[model samples]
Target: MGDTDGAEKLLEEAFYNQPFNKDIVTLVFSFYMDTADYRKLIKVAQRCMAFHLADRLCWHRLGTAHFYIGEYQSAVLAFRRSLEIEHNPKASFGLSQPLLALGLYEEGFNRFEERFVANPSINWIRAEKMHMPKWQGEPLAGKSILIWSEQGLGDSIQFSRLLAVLSAQGALVDLILHPHHSDLEGVLSTVAGINSIILIAGNRFKLQRRYDYHCPMMSLMGILKLTPAIEVANEAYISTPASHKNKWFEYQERPEKKIGIVWSTALSDAFLKEHPMHAAAKVKKSIALRQLEPLFHLSHCCFFPLQIAISEEDRQYLSKYDNICDVSEKLSTFSDTAAMIDEMDLVISIDTSVAHLAGAMGKETINLLGYVSDWRWQQNREDTPWYASMSLYQQTFEGNWEQPVNKLVRLLQ
Candidate 1:
């Protein structure tokens, strides 16, 4: 543990000295997983016997390793063993995911509640009184529901569409959106049955503020059974951005098909660097700029580069694109990106927030995905149920985006 190189040398010598030692192999697996080495963990996990472990820690580790490697069912079995040894709530929590992955919704959700605590962290947040209104699975004739935004901006944006769904079900919805999204308040407030929309700017929340129930915004998607085929939100539902209307008037002659480009994924930098086709994108804003080049050259298309504040080297790369038009001077927030997206005919991007934004805005978006995308995208499909307007162009081989880019070139032709 003191020195990684030294430890690896010692471990290699020790393993060579005792090749048949299962305990040593398990220890190595634990160490690898701890260091985020999924490939090695998979190899070690395949070799280890589940029942031979000293404690449930090995099972938990095995389960976690399986989970990371996309072996969800195996993870569930391992986590269940850990749970059976002792009534561990967190282990139960672990079981819920693999169960949900296998489409055991009701059983998974039931186990999920056992993992819920009034307050899991003592330092981050104080223990609650549990006064947060319980959703009793009652009729929502005139009941008010306060939907709070949790997680990141992209998540909030993706889930915000639920307000309409909840409202349609006869619930008076009060949206507590993040302050950075205050610009979206106007857009969101216009939706039917959304009684009020407020930004979370250090305001005191009263539990008894006439709300019958409260739920996280994302949970509604599951509640509504909005899977890929069932997902059909009104394309006209989103509100148009007011700010870009005046800015776009000057560029009306620009083209009939304008598209913005963003090409980079936010998954760990090391994982991102491993993909050679996206090697040029390590320069941060080079992706947003370089990808816009093709769109810029097309006189029939107006190209808007969305993200800004890039390193100087990336700016130099972007400077070489002769047709580059600067929108770094225009984009301020996701709303600004949404506005630019609204004015565009299509969006071509890597796995990023811009893709999520374009999809939520119901714009025809082409998402350039790496060989392995997140679990939400699952394994197969050209389209995501989460965004009907979005189309996917996925890498056929690991660490390669050339195939997707070539496919995009053919489609664009």
Candidate 2:
């Protein structure tokens, strides 16, 4: 039978007839899971347990099926049972996430530390250990601390705040920053405690020994216990003589609120794969353009794409909008992006590097979020704790932007 309901009915009859048959039970249970009939799957799985046919795989399924259906507590119980029978690596990973989601932090962090062992990324497996540097707070007279950037450009910029704080704390900080962000190094080096800057990919640092204490950039957020309540400078922190060229002083001279728009999605494929807190469940050019259309219409906004040349459908959508301006083809470096963003009063962007730029500059930012967002943002809140000036506007439902965009338009007005 081609109909899923028909297949399900037939499986139910067969399961009733031969309830203890492992092969038949597995097939029917798999079908139930695939069809997303979680309640039925649970019943079938329980029957397997009653028949003493419970296996590691079945228990894993039982736990994850509950997890998928939002029965997190029950999912935890099932996952524990799965672990009791046999150590299932995937189940450990699965158990870790829901526990974290439920705010079981101490336990969750312990489990998160096992990510490399339970299930590791390819990079983790192949990644060469760079002799984990130490951050020794001793000897204010001579020791250097290396601040290593991690994850994405946004992360680097967001955590760069720590550099200033640590520098002020009287440590001689040396930054290991992304080459793209080296334009920021000069300003960053001038921070109260920083002694030098080294671009990780470009410059060679001659040192007597490795850094005293090495910190991945993200950990600074937790270390500082930074929340939205922290006060920040309301002006730009980085500037360059190069960015000053062709800089529209006249635009600054005017009274109009100049806003920058960044519509191009970054890491589109990576996000689509994980679907963690998925904002855009899938990438459809028409939908992406529609999500962005409202920003272009704002009178105070100057819409800019840091990049062009997505799908043809997206290109056509851009063609239809007269206000969309992309000088990204000419802007290859963060310095150029910084120069343009410097001229703007605010930035309205998707979750991209432009958001990072705006946040780092202490510009007012409104981040357009997809329905399912990243894990870092957590659930529904209008503001992020990481950036003081940044506010979030999220899609209420998946693959729908009208309501959110309408909300943004009203906010813009």
| Candidate 2 local lDDT, 309-378, one digit each (tens) | 3656766676766556555565655666676777776787777767766776677888877665544454
**Which residues of candidate 1, in runs, are more than 4 Å off?**
1-7, 10-31, 96-130, 178-192, 202-208, 222-228, 231-236, 243-246, 265-302
User: What is the lDDT for 381 in model 2?
Assistant: 76
Report how far off residue 408 is in candidate 2 (Å): 1.4
Model 2 scores what on Cα lDDT?
0.63
Sliding window of 10 residues with minimal summed lDDT for model 1: 118-127
The best candidate in terms of TM-score: 1
Please list the C-alpha lDDT of all candidates, in the order they appear: 0.62, 0.63
Every model's TM-score: 0.77, 0.67
